[model samples]
Target: MTNNLSVVINSDAQQVWTMLREPARIAQWHGWNADDQEAEINEIYFGPNVVEGADHTSLVVDGGDVFTLKPVPTGTEVSVTRAAIDHNSEWAAWDEDITQGWLTFLHQLRFALERHPHGKRRTFFFSVPGTGGSAIENLGLSDVPAPGDPYSLTLPTGEEISGKVWFRSNHQVGLTVHNYAEHGEGLLIVADQPAIADVRPDGGSLAIVSTYDLGAHQLDAIRNYWDKWRAENYPTSDPVH
Candidate 1:
């Protein structure tokens, strides 16, 4: 099966290339902060299995995934052609989950380069077993909006957020929250995971909240509020740190 995912970021090819190759820059969007994040990144991205294109426009990472960069009028188009999954492999059971993860990370990369080019992000993530409901609907965003459309809504938690609609897809919705970061920039991604045979029988819901430049107290407050909100809304869900 040919699975190719791409995103256009508002940055030159060189800048996007830097993000793809540099460890510190990769941390800005690849995954949430963790004690072993740095080591994990080094292993997966800089390990012996990786290969870089002679012209610096492509990268072949572990597991045979290929990333190619092309300069577009607006910026750079970064595309990833995923490697085929082997049923006998350890990660075969999570194939769909991995694809969804790539989608999230690609958008996060775009968000990082365009919105907070030089800033480190603080992230919050959660994955919930579906309750026969849409997670996007729960976020009060059921009415799908076109990309770049402006929106303002008070969340179920009584938090007022306003920004442009980042992007929408069949299984995911992304938003820019102007009030989240210190300089009024943040990214929120909500996704619906369909049930797979022998895996995630009830389906699932996933969300990622990325913010920048927040003080410790402020970050703590935001985390606490969301923690309470998630507990109330997704009592059975397990949050991924």
Candidate 2:
């Protein structure tokens, strides 16, 4: 079935458009800075199978995926509408992965723009096999609040974050990683990586920080900490076949 999601950001359409359309800006809110953003954006948005709106407010990509920007009283309401999934396709799991990936990335976009516009970001990501159930407690989030409720915790790396619970489900935990009054907004996502049938269960955690002017030294520090933490906590996942 089709999947879609939207967020009311606290900025106007023009500003959001700049962030979305500009490759350098997209890196601040979307993927790791190492991503080939311009290439990906062109492939997805400017390719042959795309239709653009007159005001450039919306686009229809191949396979009927729709991306839209609508001005609201507060700011822009950004949205994505993915075409329905075909469960019988060979890439059925890939279809679900894209839908969930968009959900996470769109929220990252909203958090960056609203909290720290024009910021740069660093990402930390790793995955391991699940213990056949949720690892919320193992991750030290035993005190996590109800969805939308405010919460704060210090990671094993000694960094602390405070923000409302963005989402939580059997397979994932999403946090609006507002690190006290010091750092800008960020997103921490814990998810079960999708797998084709007959594969072992695996879970992943990702951290994306909106660092306004922090240099590479700072990013390296956080990255090192996460690497150590993951090694100490998560078990080695199954090797690829």
> How many clashes does the backbone of model 1 have?
0
Model 2: lDDT to the true structure? 0.66
lDDT values for all models: 0.83, 0.66
**Model 2: how far is 167 from its true place, Å?**
4.9
Each prediction's total of clashing residue pairs, residues at least 3 apart in sequence or on different chains, is 0, 0
What stretches of model 1 exceed 4 Å from their correct place? 1-4, 197-199, 239-241
Q: Per-prediction RMSD in angstroms? A: 2.1, 4.0
State the lDDT of candidate 1 residue by residue for 50-159, as single tens digits: 99999889999877888899999999999888788899998888787777777778899999999899998988887787774667888787785798999988887667
TM-score of every candidate: 0.92, 0.78
Tens-place lDDT per residue, model 2, 89-175, is 776767766776677777778877887685566566555655443345556765688878988888765677788887665555677
Best by lDDT: 1
